[model samples]
Target: MGKLTATFLKEIILLARDRSGILVLFLMPAVLVVVVSLVQENVLKTAGETGIRVLFIDHDRQSTGQVIEELLSGSGAVEIVKDVDGHEIDEETARTLLAKGDFQFCIIIPKGVTDGVKKRVEQQITEALNAGNEAQNEPVPLPSLAVYFDPLVQGAFRASVVNVLHRVVLSMEMEMKARALSNMIPVRMNLILQEIMGPNLINVPVGIFPRMDSKWGSERLLDVKIEPASRGGVEELPTSVQQNVPAWALFGMFFIVVPLGGSLIREKQDGTMLRLLTLPVPHVTLLSGKVIAYVLVCTVQFSIILLVGRFVLPIWGMPVLEMGSSPAAIVLVVVSAALAAAGYGVMLGTIFRTYEQASMFGPVSVVIAAAVGGVMVPVYVMPEFMQKISNYSPLAWGLNALIDIFVRQGGIRSVLPEILYLLSFFAGAMLIAWGVFIRRGRTGG
Candidate 1:
């Protein structure tokens, strides 16, 4: 027990004196969280979470055009720009801007759409109403809408925009058809009544007919209720800070492998490890001390990032980090991740004979692990094979557990699988290090 405590204190002192190691562990992730979160916030805005800027040139400048602008504005999905440089934007100018990628979308309402649509719709309804006759009404031409999009716009985004426009136009067309039918119904009824009793209907007032409203066609018959999918808990919306903080914190924590590996290499090269092996204490005790010291460093690293995310990030107009109700789960996850990281460090140190090899390999391997683990992008968004590959990364396990707690309002049980995976990885890595350490001792080179 005394040996273990002494070794732990020594490791801590060595780590404190290593300025480069301290910088790698602390400053890098702090800056990563702040910069990446702000950049992602802008990405969210571009995705229309806040709003997308759209160039709307309504050449028809009548009812259909006015209605399109009003409905788009009410939906709150886009910022409508009808004018550019103090002048009403023409179709040619809007097209030029879209092609240049200065604007993502441009909508043009073709001329005579309103009058043409109304005339065509009324004629179609009239023809349909008198279907028993010869049906001699000619087909009237209707103007189609033109929607120009930037070449770089994604297919999904274009589909979404097209869908919104389709719904709005369909609603307007249905209302127009309804109004035309309403007008024709009274006319047909009055003609029949007059033909049947010409003199008897002389004093009849027009007020006897039922009133029709344009809004009636737009009202939905059945409504859909949207509910959140949560574990019957208060649903927390994930913000950029919430995501990047945990992601890069895991990144920094795993980076402990660098210093841990370097420390091991230094001791081996200086004959300190050989001298320590001569002592009565088991090598596992020495490893335990290194693990404990680095785990404490990792915990502090996680805390600094949390504090920055909760307090400092919000000052930059970011959402406050809402750690879920389970603080115990968070602590457990951090410790498990730190242990896994330390074990990897010890393994690398045992295998490598020089600090340069350990330093280069340690950071590079961690970056590869982080890349596959959903640190930079969510696993679901990756290609199919990469998604399967991500399941094997320890960083993925830690990141998943943290995200579950941070956004899903999860508890200990919610992250049990990830915790177990991380702990298993720690155990596996240590065993490999032990095997390597014993083999080298017997060779006596």
Candidate 2:
């Protein structure tokens, strides 16, 4: 037992003395966590704030053009560019701006919009009289008619234009009704018609106009707040650790196993294992002690990363303990990850006859594992085929179990299946390593 303890302490001291290993295990994961969180935040912001800039070309010099400009300006959602020194805006220029992504939408009021409004007003009044409706009845709501804005703009922008059209059309309809009634009445009754067309009638539609709700505009951007399930509180932004820590920790833990496996191969090549065999110490005991030492190293590395994530990334104040309600679930993730690292180290040590072979191949294994385990890219974003392949990687099992505990707030019972799969992978790798070791012993190599 004393010899095994000495061996464990020796391995720990050796790892601590290696500055390059310490940086790879600790500092790299910490920096990567910050970078990934910032990138994700920027992506979400861009997607939400993407808006169209529109140019308005008004050919009508009449009050109708002024009315149109006023209506457009009322909507804070749109930026209407006006009074360019150029002649009428041609379709060619509009298409060119749209192609260059300068303008997503455009509006054009042709020279005869006022004449069209007058004709539309007369037709509306004729229809109202023919229907035999009482004058007291509310005027029919006008259908919105857009001039030339792209239909593919954000829903808020489209609704803004529609709302402006409704106001303008309603105002024209009220004016036409007043004129029609004045014509029908005798000179003595003209006073009554003029009195009926008071401010109330002209402005009723404006007051009841269906303005676009700002809340509805936000909904189009999918602005949803994600919060810790425990507090029921909301977060304006995702927690930094939530967005960044997993990938870095996973990749770091993976690389840490390489030096462990390489060290074992070196000891075997130097005949150190043969010298140790002269003692009464069992091989399994030595192996288990080595694994425990590596676990301590990995745990210290992970703890540092977690500390940096909490302080540097500062993803909300939700305590790490609040990641999951069950303490056992957290323990299970750590144990499973440690077991997987041990199994991989043992397999690499047994497969290679020399330190050179292990060093050459161990990094390749780590890279492949990182890629398939959603460490390089999230599993959610991977292609379906690649996602399916990820299920076969042991790192994926460990990461999935951790994500279930941290992100989903799952309990031990919820993560049992993942734990089982990870244990199975560890057992399989260990068995292969044992087989290789026994074969080499029989060959006397």
Candidate 3:
């Protein structure tokens, strides 16, 4: 057998002999997956139960203002705050609060609304009479009521407010009309004012029609989109079987190369590497074997998670298989993850002086990778700046590719660029690890 092949076989044998290392690399990921999934589910459920908070600002101190407040408060959906600790809220305070997202909506009632509505109705009546004359038809004007509301409210809530305001205005108009008709005498004299030294009442009618238009000073609601999802659209993996399965799976795959890289560091630290220089086995063969062993461990760990996710959890990721190109995409995700994890392990092993340090750093590196790559939080829900930063991490590419396969139902071609990027990341990380290891050997550092 080739020296490299023999070295790889020896590494695999060594790994099989270490039962504790085998469990850490294999069983831990399954546990992590379960824990993360449960936490996500609970958070999502809680968020859904509590509706958004909104505030009401009543500017009009009149009866109409009271009616508006009553209408809004009557709905169990809203909470009305008339004063904040004995201090009245102003427009500026409302704006500041809204900008901070303290409240989803705010209602503002302009002063003189009742007076404005009355004047507007009179003006509409006069306009109707003129229009009637031009059309040679009897004038029947409608009330032109004005209802003003702030434009910074949410769309759904604003629409509800408008509907309630229309009802109140209609009631006011009906009451005014009833009082005016009741005061009209049986024989109303249209020319009473003419004979009494005035001709202003010559065309006066017993009852005048009020000119009313549904909208006079209404404004559109604020346009804001809020995502009310837990993990902001991140998929839920099953947590019943494993507490930190996903985290472990990701880290386990990554740590597979640690031992391979650790071997060189160990030899240097023990002074055995120099003593072994007299042997026939080449240095390149020893490194090759270690890398191969890491690949094998990563492959096994990945396969176990896939089987558990499929059969045990019954959790089917996006049906990429139906796309006829999912197989290629799946292959790409697995290969990329394996390569990147191996490279990461190698680098950690090379940098650390002892096996304990390499082991500790392995999990730490996985956490950092998950954080930057969006394993903890979804990239889409993250702030725009964070999404930009995530692009630099290999975990981001791997997770994205996996999400495409599971959530977006993207085919192989759709994720080709991501796969290529991951591959490049793996190659780059591996190159760095190789360089560090070789340099350490040469410098005896």
lDDT of each: 0.87, 0.65, 0.60
Better of 1 and 2 by lDDT: 1
Residue-level error in angstroms, candidate 3, position 109:
20
Best by TM-score: 1
- The candidate 1 region of ten consecutive residues with least summed lDDT is 436-445
Candidate 2 least-lDDT 10 residues: 211-220
lDDT (0-100) at residue 255 of candidate 1? 90
Candidate 2 per-residue lDDT, tens place, 155-271, comes to 755675566566655554554456544443333233444578864543233323333332332123345775555322322233435545655676666665578788777777777
In candidate 1, stretches whose alpha carbon ends up further than 4 angstroms from where it belongs are: 99-101, 127-142, 188-208, 269-272, 352-361, 382-386, 442-445
Check candidate 2 and list the clashing pairs: 240-315
Tens-place lDDT digits, model 3, residues 188-220: 334444567575545655455343333332222
Residue 114 Cα positional deviation in candidate 1, in Å, after optimal superposition: 2.3
TM-score, one value per model: 0.87, 0.60, 0.55
Question: Highest lDDT, which number?
Answer: 1
Runs of candidate 2 with Cα error greater than 4 angstroms are 49-240, 315-322, 441-445
| Candidate 1 lDDT, 171-197, residue by residue in tens | 888888888887777777777789898
